[model samples]
Target: MKAVGTSESHADAVAICLTQADYKGHLCEGLYQLKTYVDEVEYGGCDKDAVPTILKESPVCAWVDGNNGLGVIVANFSMNLAIQKAKKCGIGWVVAKRSNNYGIAGMYSLKALDAGFLGLSFSNATPLVAPSRALEGALGANPISVAAPATNEDYFLLDMSTATVAHGKVEILGRKKLPVPTEWANPVTGALTPLGGSDPSSNYKGFGLAMFVEILCGILGDSGYGPYVRRYGDVHQAANIGHCFIAVNPNYFAPGFEERLSDLMNYIRNMQPADPERPVIVPGDFERQHMSTVDHQGGICYAKDLVKICQMLADRLNVTHLSPLI
Candidate 1:
C-alpha cells in the first residue's frame, strides 16, 4: 500500500486488516481488494493522507469524519475510540462518514472481543443489491458482524452480508468463469434470506437487515445511503461510505457471561448432525478452522492467479515482486 502512495500508518492499517481477512479465509476481502484500494487512492476517490477526526463525542458515543480516508484507518480509529469509551461507560458506539470500504466487518468486532467486550460492527457499502421486490439496485450489500467472547479465549463471531453475497464474491466467481450458486446472488430469485434459502418467502428478512445496517451506518453516521451511495468501482468522486462500531461490557448485564456463552456454544457443537459426515458448526467455527490451517502452513498460500495479480501490481508500482517462500 505504501508503494501505491498510502501513508505508512494507513498502509499498515490496511495491510493488517487484509491479513486478518486472509487468515479467516475471506480471500475476496483480503489481498484481492488491494489493487482496487490502490485505484481508489490513485484515482482521487480516496485521500491517502487523510486522517479521521472525531466530530462530536459524549462519554459513551462519538461521531467521526473520515475525511475521505482509507476505510481501514477510519475503522480502526473509530473502533479504537469505541473501545476506549466502553472501558469507562460499559458501552460505546461510534460512527464515521466519508470512509472507503473496510476489508471485513468481523475485524472490527473482534477488536472489542479482544478487549473483553462484545462488539458489533456494521458498514454501508456501494449500492449493488436491490431491496425486496425492487427492479434495480437500491441498497448496498450492508454487512453486520457481532463478536462475543467465551471461555478459554473462544468466541462467537457472526459476520455476514445482508445481501446473499457481497459483490466481491460475485466478481470472484465471474473472474473464474464459475457458475455462482443460486443462493449466491441469484438474479432470478433476487436476494436470498439470511436463513440460507433462495426462497422468496423469507427474502424480506435480508432486505430488513440491509436496511438496519443502512440506518445505523449511513443515516446515523451522516453518510450516503441507498442510491446516494456511489456505484462499485467508480473512482469519479469521493465516496461517503459510513460505518458503525459498538462495544458493550457484558458485566454490565450479567455475571459469568463468558462461561454461559461457552456452555451454549459447546452444547450446540455437540448436537447431532443432520448428515453424519458433516457436523453442525457454530458461527465462528469455520473461520477458526481456516485460521488454524493458515497457522499450520505458517502463511497464506496465494492462488497462482493471485500471485500473478500481485506481480502486476508490483510492476505497476515499480516495486519488487514478492516471491513464494517455499
Candidate 2:
C-alpha cells in the first residue's frame, strides 16, 4: 500500500479491512485483491490522498464525497460519521459517492456493532454480474451486510454478495492454491462457472438484491448505477463506486432486542441436524469460528505464489519484502 503512494495511516486502514476478510475466511476479498488496488493507484484511477468532504449533512443523514479516494478509508469515514449521528438521533444514514473497491462490506457494519448499535452496509461495485436471462453483465456483485449485537458478545451478521460468486473466485482461486468446489461443477463437461451454470431462481433473487443495493449506493448516493460503473479489470477508468451505511440504536426500537436475538440464535445453533453430523448454525457463526482459528494459528495462510507476488510488488516499490512467516 505504501508503494502505491498511500500514507502510512491510510495503508493501515486498508490493511485492517483486507486482513479482516482473510481472517474471516473470505479469501477472495483478502490479499488476493491487493494487486488490483496497486494497479488502481498506479493507473491513476484512484487517488492516494483522500480528503473526504461532507457534501450534505443533517442530524440523521449525510452525503459524502470520497474525493475519489481509497474505498476503505472512505467507508470508514462515512460509517463513523453515521455512528456519531446515530448516537444522538437513535438512527443515522450516510451515503458516499466517488469511492472505489471497498474489499469487504462487513467491516463497516461491525463498526456499529462495536458502538453498541446495529449496522447496515451496502455497496455497488464493478459491473460483473449478468441479470437473469441476460447474456452479459448489467449489474455489479453488489453486497449487503448487516450486524446486530446480541448478548454476551454474540451477534448476528449477514454479509454476502448478491451475485452467485464474486468474480475474483473465477481466477484468484488458482492463485490462492485452492481448487474449485465440485458442487457447482457440470456433470457432463466437469466445467464449473458459478455465473455460467447459474441457477435461474438464485440469479433472479441475486439480481433483485443487487438492484436494491444499487438503488441505495448508486442511485441515491449519486454514483454510477449498474453498468455505468467502470469494469473490474479496467484500471484506466475510475470506478466511482458508491456505498451506504445505516446505524440504529436497537434499544430505541424495543426493549430486550439483544436478549431476544441471543435466545433465537442460541436455540437455532443447538437444534438437531438432519444429517446428525452437520449441525444448523446461524449466519455469523462461521465467521466467529474462522476468526478464532486464525488467532489460534497465529498467522494467516497464504499461497506461495501470492507471497511471491507480494514480494515482487515490494521489489517494484523498493520496500522491504514480507518475511514469509507462513
Candidate 3:
C-alpha cells in the first residue's frame, strides 16, 4: 500500500512503470503487430497521403486489428490517439476490434486526463455475467473507467466492472486455492453473483449496467455480444473483442470549469466519513495513495513468485531488461 501525492504526479509514475514494463517483454509481441497495422492501413484511407501520414502520425483515429496481439499495447496506442485528437477537437472517440485483454481500463483513461482532458474508456471481454434471472452467462465482466484532473485535489478516477464481481477477482481467489465467498460467486454452479450479489440484493441493477456496456462496446463497435464472446483460456482461437474510448476538454463546455470543479471537490472532501478514522475520499484517492507508497519504496512490491515468472519470460524473449519503476 502506498500514498501518492496529487493525481497528475501519480499518473506520471504509473506511466514510467508501464513504459519500463513494456520494454521488458510485457507486450513486445503486440507492439510488433501494431506496427504492422500502421503499415497496412497507411495507404488505405482518406488521403492517399492519409495512410502514410497516419503511419507516421502521432495521433489519429485507428483500428488496431490486433491480429491477436497484446491488448495492453494496442489499447495504449488507441487511447493515445483519442487523447491527441481531443486536444485538437472538443472531444475524440475511438473503437477497437480484434484486441486482446488490457490489464486495467483506468490505466488508459488516466493517460488522457494526465494530458488535461477528461478521459473515458471501456472494453468488452469474455462473457461471464448473467442477465436478469437467467443463469446462463450472457455478458462480459465489461469495465468502464474515467479520469479527470482536479484543481485542489487528486485526479478523479472511476473504474468499475459492470458485473457483480469481475472475473479476475474470482480467478485470484481460485488461484490462492481459497473458497470464494458464497455471496461473491455461485459455489455449486460456478457463476458470478450479480453486483450487490452479496447481501442486500442489488444485482439486478448491475446486470442492467453490464448489458448497457455490452451494447455500447460489443454492439456499437460491431463486436459480437452475449455468450457468443469467447473465453481467453479456451482451447479455441483467441477472441476478437471490442473497446471504445472518449476524451473531452471540459473547457469546451463552460468557462472556468476547473475552478468550479475544485469547489465541488472540496465540498465532497469535507463531508462526514462513514468511519471516523478514515477520511471521506473520492475516486482516485486510493490509487493516488498507492502510488506514493511505491515512490518512497523505490518501486512496487512484486511477489517473489511472480518475479520469477517475469524473469523467465524476459529471458526467453531476450528483450532489453528493465528495472521496476517504483
Candidate 4:
C-alpha cells in the first residue's frame, strides 16, 4: 500500500503514517464506493468540506454529509478535532453519524495520545451481536478505544470491541482470503459469536463492554439502535452508524497526572513475571511490540489486493500517489 512521511518524530511519524494509510485504504475506499451511487449526503445538515472546517466546529460537533464522502476522512477529520480541542481546552468531544467504516478506533484514540492528551473513542456499528443468549441479532458489537501517555514506555492504548473479537478482525481475515479461526466463528450456522459466546472466558466481559458502548454512542445520541442500524459496504442502503469521542487532559485532575500514571504502571511492571523470560504485559504492550516489529522488518504489511484498490482510488481522486512504507 502507499505510505508517506511526516515531520513528526519517529514514534509520532510511525503512528501518523499508519493511520493515514489506514484511512485511505479502508475508510476512503468505502466513501468512494458510496459516493458513486448516492446523490445527496447529510451530516447533521452540513455539506462536504475539506478536513479543516470540519475540525473547527468543536463540541456540538460537525458532520461530513459524506455526499457520502469518505467516512475515514470524515472520521479522521473529526477525531483530529477532538485531539486538538483536548490539547487546548483540556478535553474535546465529537460524534459522527451517516459515516461508513472508519477503520480502527485505536488509530483515532492514539491521535489524542500522540498529542499529549488521553484519548477516548467509541463507535456503534451495525447490529451483529446478540445480547447474551438469544440467537437473533439485537445489539451491536459497539467498540471502545482509549490511549494514555506513558513516560517510561510507548503510549498505553486499549482498543477492543465489546464483542468477543471485533468484527473488523473477522473482516481482516476475510480480506486475507483466509478462514477465520475455528474458535472465532461459529462453524455450523455462519453466525458470529458474542463476547461470551459459550466460552465463558473473557468474551462475556467484552460483550458487556459492547453493550455499554451501544448505549453511550447509540442510545444516548438518539442514533439508530438495535435492528434498525444498517450494514456497511452495502451500496443499496445508507450507513447510519454513530460514534462518540471524549478527550481528557490529565492535568485537569492532577498537576502530575502523567508522572502518577507512570508510577502506577511501574508498580505493575515490577511484579514477578508469570514466566521469567516473558515478563508481565500491560495494555498497549502488544501494539507497541507490533510497531517495533514492523519498524525492524522495514515496513508494515497490507493485503496486496487492498493496496491495488487504494491505487485505483488515488487515481480516481487525482490525489498524489502515496509511497510505500519501506
Q: Model 1: per-residue lDDT, tens digit, 32-113?
A: 8988888898889999899999999999999999999999989989999999999999999999999999989999999999
Provide the RMSD of all predictions against the true structure, rounded to 1 decimal.
2.0, 3.0, 9.1, 6.8
* TM-score (C-alpha, index-matched) for candidate 4: 0.70
Question: Per-candidate TM vs. native?
Answer: 0.94, 0.92, 0.74, 0.70
Report the C-alpha lDDT of model 3 over 1-326, residue by residue, as the tens digit. 01112134323433443544333222321122222222222322101111101222324454444444445555676787788788887777777666655656777888888888889988887776666565656677788888888786457888777776666567657667988886667676666766667434778887777777777677766665767676534523556677777889898897877787777777888999989999987777766666666666765565444456555544644544446554
Question: RMSD to the native, candidate 1?
Answer: 2.0
Question: lDDT of all the models against the reference?
Answer: 0.87, 0.85, 0.62, 0.60
lDDT of model 1 at position 324: 85
- Clashing residue pairs in all predictions, respectively, total 0, 0, 12, 7
lDDT of 4 by residue, 1-326 (tens): 11222122322423443454344333322322332222222222222332323423544344323233334555676677776677777788776655544556776787788778888888777777656554555667776789898775456777766666656567667767788774455655444567666454555665678778877666665556667777443444655566777778888776877777788777887899978998777777766676566667765566566567657766765656557775
After superposition, candidate 3 runs with Cα above 4 Å error: 1-64, 198-200, 304-326
Off by over 4 Å in 4: 1-68, 84-89, 168-182, 199-202, 302-326
In candidate 4, what residue range of length 10 has the lowest lDDT sum?
Answer: 1-10
Q: After best superposition, candidate 1 residue 249: deviation in angstroms?
A: 0.8
lDDT of 2 by residue, 43-113 (tens): 89899788799999999999999999999999999999999999999999999999999888899999999
Q: After superposition, which runs of candidate 2 have C-alpha atoms over 4 Å from their true positions?
A: 173-199
Poorest lDDT segment (10 consecutive residues) of candidate 1:
189-198
TM-score of candidate 3 against the unseen true structure: 0.74
Q: Number of clashing pairs, model 4? A: 7
